[model samples]
Target: MNTSDDDLLDRAFLALADPARRRIIARLSRGPATVNELAEPFAISKQAVSKHIQVLEQAQLVTRSRDAQRRPVHLDPARLEALTAWIDRYRLVREEQFRNLDAVLSEQAASRGRQTKDPS
Candidate 1:
């Protein structure tokens, strides 16, 4: 894995640590949203939402663009893929181990069934 990717991943996980930011990401997952649009569902102020967006932007999880006076935010799914990739590595390992265990159990069960069978 790339060293800088690790650093970026750390930044992303840290940013995701905040409930507000995670909510923001969740909102963005549905579609892109303007700052005011993002703030509407929450009790927080637009400025507060902007701060959360800034944190996400720093983590490279969100991107922004001008839509008139609005700074619309969109999810950067590449970072999401990176995060998923990080998690998937361990998930795959665990899955592989489980599959191996399943095979061993299957073999043991088959062996026992064979021994107990009536021979003609």
Candidate 2:
């Protein structure tokens, strides 16, 4: 990955490191919500929730849009998708490696079986 991609992943992961910020993201995943709405379920103040929202905003994980008197925070699926894609790439690589290992083991077992049967 490029430096910019590394920086973005760093920011995104750091922002999600906090439980409150993670909860905020989870809530936004269900739908958009205002700062007040997000704070309602937390023990923290609305201001604290706003701070969490700011972190998410900086990470490009969430966005805010003006809706009349309210500025609602919405989850940015594109960024989430990017993260997922990065993870899936590594996961797929590991899976392929395991499949190759399994094939090798199976071949080795078959070779041993044939050798024993031939009694050479």
Candidate 2: residue 22 lDDT (0-100): 86
Instruction: State the local distance difference test value for candidate 1.
Output: 0.87
Worst ten-residue run, lDDT, model 1?
A: 111-120
Give per-residue CA lDDT, model 2, range 10-116, as digits (tens).
88888989999988888888999999999999999988888889888888999899989999999998988888899999999999999999999988887775654
Off by over 4 Å in 1: 1-3, 99-120
Residue 76, model 2: Cα distance from true site in angstroms: 1.1
Q: What value does the lDDT take at residue 61 in candidate 2?
A: 94
- Residue 4 of candidate 2: its Cα lDDT? 87
- Clashing pairs for model 1 are none
Q: After superposition, how far is residue 2 of candidate 1 from its true place, in Å?
A: 13
lDDT of each: 0.87, 0.88
| Residue 120 lDDT in candidate 1 | 47
Please, what is the TM-score per model?
0.72, 0.77
Pairs with backbone N, CA or C atoms under 3 Å apart (clashes), candidate 2 = none
